[model samples]
Target chain A: MRSTKPRRWGERLIEGAIKSTGIATIVFVLLIFVFLLKDSLPLFGHAKQTASLLGTRWLPTSEPEQFGLIPLLLGSLYVTLGAMVISVPLGVACAIFIAELAPQWLRELLKPLVELLAAVPSVVFGALGVLLLGPWFAKTLHLPVGQFAALGSLLLAFMAIPTIVSVSEDALHAVPRALRAGSLALGATHWQSITRVVLPTARSGLIAAGLLGLGRAIGETMTVLMVTGNAAVIPQGLKGFILPVRTMTATIAAEMGETAHNSTHYFALFFIGLLLFLITLVVNVVAEVVVHRMGREAK
Target chain B: MSALPSAVGRTLTQTGEDGSQSAGQSVAEEAFLPTCEEVPCAPNILRPEGEIKLEARSLNMYYGSFQALRNVSMAIPERRITALIGPSGCGKSSFLRCFNRMNDMIDGFRLEGDVLLEGNDIYRRDLDLAYLRKRVGMVFQAPNPFPMSIYDNIAYGPRLHGRPDRSELDQIVEQSLRQAALWDEVKDKLRQSALGLSGGQQQRLCIARVLAVQPEVLLMDEPASALDPTATFHIEELMLQLMEHYTIVIVTHNMYQASRVSQYTGFFLMGELVEFGHTEQIFETPRDKRTDDYIRGRFG
Candidate 1:
C-alpha cells in the first residue's frame, strides 16, 4: 500500500508537469504577441507617419521615411501565390500516386524519401536558390537579374512540397476503403472512382494541406531573402513573377539589424512582424478547422 | 445411405454428361459428390424456373497460398433471389463478390475456372470491368452512401457513364430512388447529404445508387447485416420487390434471412458448396448432412 502511494505521487507529479508545460506554451505565445503589440503601438503616436504606413511606397530610408506597406504586402502575396501555383498540383499528384497507385514496395520507398525532404535545412535551400536557380533563370528567361519573385517562389515551392505531399497523402489514405469499393462496384473506372469519389471525400483535408503549404511558403524568410533580390517595389500585374520583389518576412529580416532600436523604422518592422504572425495564425487556424471537418466527415 | 435411389442415378448421369469432355470438370464433380455418398447431390433437385443469369464453373479461388474457396459451382436464375448462407470465412461473401469481380481489387487474389454472366465469360481478359460492374452492381453489408446530396448519390452512376443533362439526371435519380422504394422518404430533401439519412434509408439509397446504373444483376453481401430488425425487414421486402426486375444474389450469415427472402439457397461450409436446392427443401429436407446440421443450428 505504501509503495503504491509513492507510485501514485510520482504519476501525479508527472501529470502536473505535463499540464503546466502545455499551459506555459500557450502563455509564451500570448506573451510574444503582447511584446510585438507593445513595440508597434509606439507608431500610432505620430498620426501622419502612421497613416503613411498604408501608402503605396515603402521607401523607409528616403527623406521623411515613407513606410507604405502595400508594396511589401503585395510582394508577399505574389511570391506565396506563385509558390502555391507550382506546389499544389505537383504535391497533390505526388500524394495521389503515393496513396493509390504505388505498390507496397514503392510506397514504402517513396514515403520516407518524401518525408526526408522536410529534414533538409532551409538555409541549404536558400544557398541552392542563390547559387543555382537564380543563374539558371537569368540565362533562360533572358533577364538581367535572375533574383526575382519567381526564383524565390520556385525555391519556396520545393520547401513546401514535402509538407503538402505528406499531409495530403494522409488525407487520401484516411478516405474509407468502402467508398472506393462502392464506387468501383457502381461501374466507375479506377480513375473515375479516384477523381469522382475519393478526391471529393478528401476535399477538406486537401484544402487543409494546401493551406499548410501556403503558411510555410508565406513565412519562409531565408530562401526568399536570398533569392528575391530584396527589392521593396510594387511588382506589376502577372509579369510581377519574373520581377524582383520583397516579402514581408524578408523585409523584417533585412532591416531589423540596421534600424535604430526605439525608432519609427524599428516599430514599423515590429508591426510587419505582427502582421506576418497574424496572417500565419489565421492560415493555421483555418487549416486546423478544415482538418477537423474532414475528420468528422470521414467518420 | 441411399434412400433417394432415383435422384442419385439421375445426378450420376447428369454429372457423366457434364463431365465427359473436361478432366477438371470431373474432378470438381467428384470432390463434392464423392464426399456425400450417403446423400444425393443437391444440385440435381427441382431447378428454379428461370434462365441462368450467372454461373460459376468449377471455380477455385486462392489468396496467395491460402485457399478461400474450393471447387464450387452454382447457377443463379434470372430475376430470382438466390441466397448464399454460411458462417464467417466460409467463402459465401467471396462467392458473391466473384459475380461482379469485386475480389479483383485484393492483392494476391487468384482465380481458376470461370464466372459467366448471361452466358458470357466475365473473367475473360478482354472483358470491360466497368461494363461488367455496371451490369452486375453490388450493395455492401454496411450502408455506404457517398457523402454527397441524396440526389447526387443516385445521379453519380448515370453521370459517370455519360454526361446526362441536369433534367435527365433528375429523372434518373427519381426513377432509381422510386424503384428502391426510397423516393417518398427523400423527395423533399434531394439536396441533403446522404450521410444525413437513417441507416435503413442509406441502405436503400445504396440500392438506388446501384439501380441507377441499370444493372441486370444485383449482388448483395449481407445487405441488412448492419441494420436493425425493422431495417432488415425493409431491405428484405425491397429485395423481394427488386426480384421482379433484377436477378439478385445475396450472401448472408443469417439463416432465417436466407430462408425468408431467397427462392434458391446454397449452403457453404469450409469453402465448399455443401448443398444448393429450393429454399424450402434445403431447410426442410437437406440432401447433405452438413446442410441438415447447419439448418438445425448444429456446428456451422
Candidate 2:
C-alpha cells in the first residue's frame, strides 16, 4: 500500500486536470452566450427603433440613423451559398479520389498536404483577396470597384475546401471493405461500386461534412471584411454578386469601434453577434446528430 | 430420395446438347459420373465425369514472398458439388478464389499457369472481369447484404449488367429468393432493409443476390460455417437442390459435411491436393496414408 501511494496520487492529479479542462470549455461557451445576451437585450426596449432596423436601408450615420439588417443578412446568405456551390462538389470529388482511387504512395502524399492547407493563416487569405483577387475581378468583370461580394465569396470558398475535403474523406474511408467486395463479386465495376455502395453508405457523414463547411464559411469575417467594399445596399438579384455589400460579421467588425458605448448601434451589433452564434450552434448541433446516426448505422 | 435421380436425369437430358448424340458416348461419361442415386450410400470408386466445367492446369499462387499453392491441378465436373477439405491454411480457400480471380485484389498477389472456365482461359488479358464475375458468383463465409431493401439487394447484380425494367427486376427478385428458399419468409417484406434479417436469412439473401445475376457456377467459401445447426442443414439441402443446375465448389473444415453433401471430394495438405475421388471412396477406402490418417482422425 505504501509503495502504491505515490502512483495513486499522480493518477488522481492527472484525472483532475483532464476533468477541469473539459468543464472549462463548457463554462467558457456559456459565459460568451451570457455576455452576448446581456449586451443585446437593451436594443429590444426601443420598440420603434428596433422596428426601423428591419427595414430596407442601413444608413447608420444619416439623419435619425437607420439600421436595417436586410442587406447584411442577404449579403451573408449570398456569400455562404456561393461558397457552398463552389466547395461541395469540388471537395467531395477530391475526397473520393483521395480515398478510393489514389494509389498508396499518392494517398500518403496528398492527405498531409490537404491537412497543411488548414494551417495557413486566415489573414493570409484576406491579404490575397485584397491584393490580388479584388483587382482581378474588377478588371475582368468591368466593375467600378475591385472590392465586391463575389471576391469575398471566392476567397471564403478557398478557405472552406480543406475542412470539407478532410471530413468527407474520413467519411468515405469509414465504409467497410466488405461492401466493396460484395459489389465487385456481383460483377459491378470499381466506379459503380464506389458510387452506388460506398457513397450511399456514407451519405450522412457527407451531409455533416457539408454543414460543417457551411459553418466555417459563414463564421469567416476577415476575408469578407477586407474584400467586400462595406456598401450598405440591398443587392437586387444574381447581378448583385458583383455589387459591393456588407455581411453581418463584416458589419460588426468594421463598425463596433466607431459606435458609442451602450448606444443602439452598439447593442444592435451585439444582437447580430447573438444571431451569428445561434446559427453556428444550430449548424454544429445538426452535424453532430448526423455524425452520431452514421456511427450507429455503421455498426 | 428414390425419385430424385430420375428427376435430376430428366433435367440433365432436357438441358443436354441433343437427343442425336450417341448413347454409348454419354454412357462412357456416365461411367465416371456419380449419379444422384449414389448420394445416400458409398460406391466402389468414381472417376472424372461428363464435361470439365473448371480446370486449373499446373497452377501456382503466391502472395509476395510466401507461396500459398504450388503446382496444383484439378478438373471440377459440371453440375456437381466438389468439396475441398483440409486443416486451416492448407490453400483450399486460395485455390477456390482463383476461379473468379478474387485474389487479384490482394497486393502483390501473383499467379502462374492458367485457370479455365468452360475451357476458356479466364486470366487472358482481353477477358472482361465484369463478365467473368457475372458468370461465376461467390458467397463469402460471413453474410454481406448491402444495407438496402431486400428487393434491392437481390436486384443489385442484374442492375449492374443491364438496366432491367421495374417489372423485370421484381420478377428476378422473386425468382432468386425462391431459388434460395427464402421467398416465403421475406415475400411481404421485400422493401425492408436486408440488415434486419437474422444471420441465416442474411446469408440466404446474399446467395439470392448472387443468383440474380444468373451465374453458371457458385463458389462457396465455408458458406454455412457461421450458421447454427438448423441453418446449416437448410444450406446443405439448398446446395443439393441447386446441383441440378449450377456447378458448386465449396471449401469446408467439416469432414462430415463434405461426406454428406459433396459428390466429389479433394483432400488438400500443405498446398498440394493429396487425393481426389468420389466422396464415398475417399472416406471408405484408403489409398494415400495421409488421406487414410485424415479421414480416420489420426492427424489432419
Candidate 3:
C-alpha cells in the first residue's frame, strides 16, 4: 500500500506536467494574438489614415504614403496558386510512387531522403533561388530579370514538396491492404485498383496534405523576399506570373527594418502580419478538420 | 480400408436437369483410383458430379528463403465447393491464392509448378493478368467493400472490363445484388456508401462485386471466419446456392464449416497436403493418422 502511493504520486506529477504544457501552448498563442492586435489598433484611429491604408498603392515611404492592400494580397495569391499548380500533381505522383510502386529497399532509401529535404534550412533554399534559379530563368524565358513570381513559385513549390510528399504518402500507406487485394481480385489491374480504390480512400488525407503545403508556402518570407523582385503592383493574369510582384510576407519583411518605430507604416506592417496569421490559422483549421474526419472514417 | 460404396454414386441417380453430371464417365475415373502409391488416393468422390475445374500439379511456393507450400496437388471439381482446412500458417490461404495468381503481388514470392485452370497454365508469362483475374474472382477473410456506393462497388468490375450501357449496368447490378441475396435489403439504398453497411451485408456486397464480373472460378479465403454464427450461416447458404454457377475453392480453419459446405476436403499441415477426400470420410475415417488426429481435435 505504501509503495502504490509513491507510484501514483509520480504518475500524477507527470500527468500534471503534460496538462500544464498544453495549457501553456494555448496561452502563448493567445498572447501573440493580443500583441498583434494591440500594435495594429492605431491604424484604425483616424479616418484619413484608414483611407490612405486602403488606397491603390503601397508607397509607405513616399509623399501621401498610400498603403493599398490589393497589390500585396494579389501578389501572395498568385504565388500560392502558382506554387500549388506546380506542386500538387508532382507531389501526389511522387507520393503514390513511394507508397505503392517502389520496392522495399528503394522505399526505405527514399523516405529518409524526402524527410531530409524538409529538414533543410529555408535560408539555404533562398540562397539557391537567388544564385542558381534566378539566372537560369532569365536566360531561358528571355526576361530582363529572372526574379519574377514564377521563380518564387518554383522555389516555394520546392520547399512545399517534401511536406506534401511525406504527408500524402503516409495517407496512401494508411489505406488497407485488404482493399487493394479485393480490387485486384475483382479483375481490376494494379493501376486501376490504385486509382479507383486506394486514391479515393485517401482523398481527404491528400487534400489535408495539400492544404498544409499551401500554409507553408503562403507564410514563407526569406525565400520569396530574395527571389520575387519585390515590386508593389497589381500583376496581370498569366503574364503576371513572369513579372515582378511583392507578396504580403515579403512586404512586411522588407519594410519592417527601415520603418520608424511608432510610425503608421510600422502599424500597417503589423496589420499585414495579422492578416497573414489569420490566413494561416484558417488554412490550418480546415486541414485539421479534414484530417480528423479522415481518422474517424478510418476507424 | 475399402471404399464404403460412394454416396456420390447414389446422388448421380437423382441428378437434376441442370446438367448435373456428364452421363457416366465414371468408369474411367474409378479405373485410375487403384494405382495410388505414395499419397493415400481416394476415388475423388466428386469426380462423378463435375469436370475438374482447376488442377494444381506439384505446386511449390517459396517466400524469400522460407518454403510456404510443398508439393501440393489437387483437382477442384466444377460447380462445387472444395474446402482446404488446416491450422494457422499452414498455407491454405496461400494455396487458394494460386488459382488467380493473387500471390504475385508479394515480393520475393517464387512458385515452381503449374496451376492449370480449365487445362491452361495460369502461371504462363504470356497470359493476360486482367483477363485471368476476371475469370477467377476472390473474396477475402475481412469484408472489404470499396469506399463508394453499393451500386458502384458491384459495377466496378464490369465497368473496368468494358463500358456497358447505363441500362445494362443497372441490370447487372440488380442481378448481382439479387444473386448475393442482398438486393432487397440494399435496393432502396443503392446509392449509399458500401462502408455504411453492416459487416455481414458488406461481405455480401463484396461477394456481389466479384459476381458482377461473372467469373467462372471463385476463391474464398476464410470468407466467414470473421462473422457471427448467423452471418456465417448466411455465407454458407450463399456458397451452396452459388455452386450452381461458379466453382468454389475455400480456405478455412473451421472443421464444421468445411464439413457443412464442402463436398471435397483437403487437410494441410506444415505447407503439405496431408489428406484429400470426401468431407465425411475426412471427418469420420481419415486415411492419414495426422488427418485423423486433426479432425478429432487431439492437436492442430
Candidate 4:
C-alpha cells in the first residue's frame, strides 16, 4: 500500500496536467469566439449605415462608405469552386495511384515527397504565383493584368493538393485487402474491382478529404491576396474568372490594418472574419462527421 | 441434392473447350498439355464417377526468395467437396488461392508449372482473367460482404459481368440466397445493409454473393473457422448441400470438419502434400507416418 501511494500520486499529477491542458484549449476557443462577437456587434447599433453595407458596392474608403460583402463573398466562392474543380479530381486520382498502382519503392519515395509539399509555406506559393503564373496568364490569355481569380484558384488548388492526396490515400489504404481479393475472385477485372468495391468503400473518407481541402482553400489568405489583383469589384459571368477579384480573407488581411479601430469598417472586417470562421466550422464539422461514419462503416 | 449434380456437371462442362471456345479465347500455342500424374501415398481419392474439374501439376509458388508451395500437385474432382487440412502456415490457404489465381494480387507472387481448370491452363497468357475468375469464385475465412444492402451484395457479381434485366437479377438474388440457406432470414430485409447481419449470416451472404456469379468451382479458406459451434455446424451442412452443385475446395484446421464435409482430403505439411485420399481412409488408415501422427494428434 505504501509503494502504491507514490505511483498514485504520480498518476494524479499526470491526469491533472492533461485535464488543465484540455480546459485551457476550450477556454481559448471560447475567448476567441467572444472577442469576435463583441467586435462584430457594434455594426448592428448603426442600423442605417450597416443596412447599406449589405448592398452591391464595397467602397470602404469612399465618403458614406459601403461595406457590402456580396462582392467579397462572390470572390471567395468563385476561387474556392474553381480550386475544388481543379484539385478534387487530380488529388483523388493521385491518391489512388500512390495507394494502389504505384510500385512499392515508388510509393515509399512519393509519400514523403508529397508530404513535403504541405510543409512549403503559403507565402512561398504566393511568391511563385506572382513570379511565374501571373506573367504567363497575363501574356498568353491577353488579360490587362495577370493577377486574377483564375491565378488565385490555380495557386490555391496547388496548396490544397497535399491535404487531399494524403487524406484520401489514407482512406483508400484503410480498405480491407480481403475486399479487393473478394472482388477479383468474383471475376471482376482490376479496374472493375477498384471502381466497384474499393472506391465505394472509401467514399466517406474521399468526401472528407475534399471537404478538408475546401476548408484549407477558403481559409488561405496570403496566396489569394498576392495573386487575385485585389480589385474589389463584382466580377461579370465567365469573363470574371480572368478579371481581378478580391476574396473575403484578402479583404480582411489587406484592410484590417488600415481601418480605424472599432469603426464600422473595422467591425465589418471582424464580421467577415466571423463568417470565415463559421464556414470553416461547418466544413470541419462535416468532415469530422464523414470521417467518423467511415470509421464506423469499416467495422 | 439430386438436381444439384446435373446442374454442377453442366456448369463444369461449360468450363471445357466447347463451353469456352465460343467466348473470346485469345488464341495461343496448342502446347503444354499436362495430366494429373501419380504421386506416392495418394489414396486414389478421385471417386470413379467424379470428373476432374481442376488440376495443379508440379506447382511451385514463391514470394520473392521464400517458397510457399513446392512441387505440389492435386486433382479437384467436379461436384464434390475436397478438404485441404493442415496446421497454420502449412500452405493450405496458399494452395487454395491458386485455383482462382487470387494470389496474383500479391506482389512478387511467382508461380512455375500449371493450374488447369477444366483442362485449360489458367496461367496461359491468352486467358482472360475476368472469364477465369467468373468460373472460379471464392469465400474468405472472414465474411466480406460489401458495404451495401443484402440484395446488392448478391447482385454485385452478376452486375459486373454484364447488365442483366432487373427482373432476372431479382430472381438470381433470390435463388442465390436460397442456395446459401439465408433467404428466409434476410428476404424481408434485402434492402437493408448487409453489415447488419450476424457473423454467421454474413458468411452465408458471402457464399450467396459468390453463387450469384454461377461459378463452377468454390474455393473456401476456413469458411467456418471464424464461427461459433452452432454457426460452424450450419456452415458444414451448407457446404454439404453446396457440394452437389459446385466443386468445393476447402482449407480447414478442424480435422473433424474435414472428415464431416469432404469426400476427399489432402494432408499438407511444410508446403508439401504428404497424403491425398478418401476422408475416412485417411482418418481411419493414414498410409504415411506423418499423416497418422497428425490424425492421432502426434504433431502438426
The second chain of candidate 1 has a TM-score of 0.87
- Stretches of candidate 2 off by over 4 Å are A1-9, B1-47, B297-300
After the best TM-score superposition of candidate 4, give how far the Cα of residue B19 lies from its true spot, in angstroms: 42
iRMS value of model 4?
Answer: 0.7
Evaluated on the second chain alone, the candidates' TM-scores are 0.87, 0.85, 0.86, 0.85
- The stretch of ten residues in a row with the least summed lDDT in candidate 3 chain A is A1-10
Off by over 4 Å in 1: A1-7, B1-49
List, residue by residue over A1-299, the lDDT tens digit for candidate 4: 24544456788899899999999999998898889999998988888668866788888888888888899999999999999999999999999999988989999998898889888999999999999989987888789998999889988998899999999998999999888888888988878888999999999999999999999999999999999999889988988899899999999999999999999999989999988989998999999999999999998
lDDT, residue B152, model 4: 91
The residue ranges of model 3 lying beyond 4 angstroms of the native Cα positions read A1-7, B1-49
Give Cα distance to truth, residue B83, candidate 4, Å: 0.8
Q: Rank the candidates by DockQ, best first.
A: 1, 3, 4, 2
Give one digit per residue, the lDDT tens place, for model 3 in A195-264.
Answer: 9999999999999999999999999999999999999999998989999899999999999999998788
lDDT of 3 at A227: 91
TM-score, every prediction: 0.92, 0.89, 0.92, 0.91
Tens-place lDDT digits, model 2, residues B1-300: 122334445445433522343422332344433443532211212346678899876677899988888766777999999999988999999999999989998998999978999889999999999999999999999998998899999999999999899999999999999999999999999999999999899999999999999999999999999999988998999999999999999999999999999988888888777777677667776446788899999876
Candidate 1's docking class is: high
lDDT of 2 by residue, A34-56 (tens): 99999999998988668877898
TM-score attained by model 2: 0.89
List fnat, each candidate. 0.90, 0.78, 0.88, 0.93
lDDT of 1 by residue, A1-299 (tens): 25544456788899899999999999999999999999998988888779999899898888788889999999999999999999999999999999999999999999899889888888899889889988988998798798999888888998999999999999999989999999999889889999999999999999999999999999999889999988889999988988899999999999999999998999999999999999999999999999999999988
Best by DockQ: 1
